[model samples]
Target: MRRPVLATLIAAAAASALLAGCGAPAAGDAASAAGTEPGSATTPAVAGEITVLAAASLTEAFTTLGRQFEAAHPGASITFSFGPSSGLATQITEGAPVDVFASASTATMDDVVAAGAAAAPAVFADNVMEIAVPASNPAGVTALADLARPEVKVALCQPAVPCGAGAASVLAAAGLTVTPVTLEADVKATLTKVVLGEVDAGVVYATDVLAAGDTVTGIEIPADVNAATSYPIASLAASKNPHLAKAFVDYVLSGDGASVLTAAGFRRP
Candidate 1:
């Protein structure tokens, strides 16, 4: 009887040990169950504020991307300064405390990189010149050649701006020369002239015309005569929040960013 009682106690102890071993998970097993590999480093949550200086032509797309980035990164925020690429590049080179720079042309980006303000900019989009006119079609501008007519009052971005350079290239390709009535500082300002009927037509980006919706009508530039500029984005070297700045640049090169840009009529590079 004593032996049987001892055996029963031993059996009960054995069963309890088995149950404990099967029920409790090991540290590595717990990590696996949570869909993480054991001993692997996890990405830290992005948190901080960044200032982005972008080309005026990228206003609509970049604004939408900025909102999406803020939504995805709850603790992160972005402030944007949109203007001519050349001016924005100058600001970065002049120590404006910018976090990121997205220029409408490679040449403008090169200026920042040359100044050591940025590095290895990625070209994300390309834009072509187009003729933006008021919805009323007051000038009856139908083709690129119409912009050359003596009676047509045209607005253009300043020569230093990407839109102006593109317009110049397009006109040169078509062998048409017509001076602009107004030389605006940025693409948006030039577009405004067309939208407000202050000018019969404005030489701006195709994306600008699309963003204008019904307020302006776009006359397509022939592919052979059209000029396109590549957009490059980079994290500035003097960023106070370097990590956040790089994250923002990465976000702009992401698929989600491409979608917003495409919706805004920017062609993927």
Candidate 2:
């Protein structure tokens, strides 16, 4: 990261009419009024299909949850679209057929909430940044500060994405300057660059390294540079089946979803 950061805005593509970009609830009273106890309402399996748009980082975890939800609610078929949080928000706001949305950052979530396309979104988990490098450790990056050295070729996520934004905060705190070969659109892409040795080092989530296991090695970041990123989930206000959407959101907030996300490297929000 440099003294001044460039902000990138991602755009959504044309999807099915049922699919628009994600939007947030109305301000003040409407937001509060929309908030409800998870699973408080009856969540019968009302059917067409339940589509979920989530951040790219949640790909693995949500895929697992989607399977479990399908098994539990046999008639319900689920579809998922994962990418940068900003991109997902754009799709949802554009009227994507998203019944639910799970964002990697609150800022992105706020965009959806403010658009009045979603009910109040509740934060479920938080994630922190880490350095993902090849198992060989050729560059010998030991801490957040080391990326500043001119010899290091780093790859960071785009600022609009959660990991990219966290990297900015950490690098600023470390007083480091990184001339990265590129800034990726999402965290997984950055991690992939490290796994492929396309870059000497890349910033990602601690959980991603854990999931990759032997594929990549993780270097710890200083506690201060560890900015906890919040993940928020909500039922879309444009939902065709808000009742089922609410139930799915409840499942994600329940012990079942937490178990999967935590095991994958997310912390309680």
Candidate 3:
């Protein structure tokens, strides 16, 4: 009778051990199922795509910075729409799904801020107007006054654009008048006319001339007569990726970004 009781106890112990072994997951497996490593917590990756509406003058620098941003955050990416600041501002107010806006001037940015499309923007850079002529300079243009010659064909941005406004200011300061052969939608368009020799010269930002490299020659306006514009950046209020948008903005304001901008011939604020 004692041996029979002992056998039954042994059988019960074996059954209990089997159930315990089969019922519960191992500690490592439980941790993994909970989305963590057994001994460490994981950080959420900075991952998402964002669209940035930037001034045409920022094309080169911003493109470089965007690449850097993506490389720094493995799962993140950026798409850029480069255009006149005024047009971009209008797009933002019209509910375009842009994550960030980088304006060539404060006035254009103010329009967005006033519309509640964006908040207070930080000025990141300053740029002055320059006269970009074709490499050949067919009109023999040398000074700002040369643009005033009635025979010279000139290209200017539309009045609504920041580059246009800056050019206007510089002309006004110098007490000179110029009639452009064509009014372009943006600085790049104006520069293109000069590059293609469609116009004798184009009034554009100094940075635009720098970007053109060997394709164009830049004539500097006198400091006393030159006009400058401030570049401001903001994250749009309706951004689908707000965190990533803000990160890009902050990155532009960082030292790393400053170096790139400086290399691109932009003046820091």
Worst 10 residues of 1 by lDDT: 36-45
> Taking the tens digit of each residue's C-alpha lDDT, what string does model 2 give over 168-239?
988888777787889999998998999999888998988888888998989988897677789999999888
Q: Runs in model 3 with CA error above 4 Å?
A: 1-44
lDDT of each: 0.91, 0.84, 0.92
Q: What RMSD does model 3 have?
A: 5.6
Worst 10 residues of 2 by lDDT: 4-13
Write model 1 residue lDDT over 1-269, tens digit each, in one string.
35688889999999999999999988789777764577652533477898999999999999999999999989999999999999988888889989999999999899899999999999999888899999999989999999999999999989888998998999999999988899999999999988889999999999999999999999999999999999999998899988888998999999988998999998999
Is candidate 2 or 3 superior in TM-score?
Answer: 3
Error of 3 at 199 (Å): 0.8
Q: Predict model 3's lDDT versus the native.
A: 0.92
TM-score of each: 0.86, 0.82, 0.84
- Name the TM-score of candidate 2: 0.82
lDDT of 2: 0.84
Q: Kindly provide the TM-score of model 1 when superposed on the true structure, using C-alpha atoms.
A: 0.86
- Identify the leading candidate in terms of lDDT: 3
How do the residues 5-83 of candidate 3 rate in per-residue lDDT, one tens digit apiece? 8899999999999998898878888777765678554523457999999999999999999999999988899999999
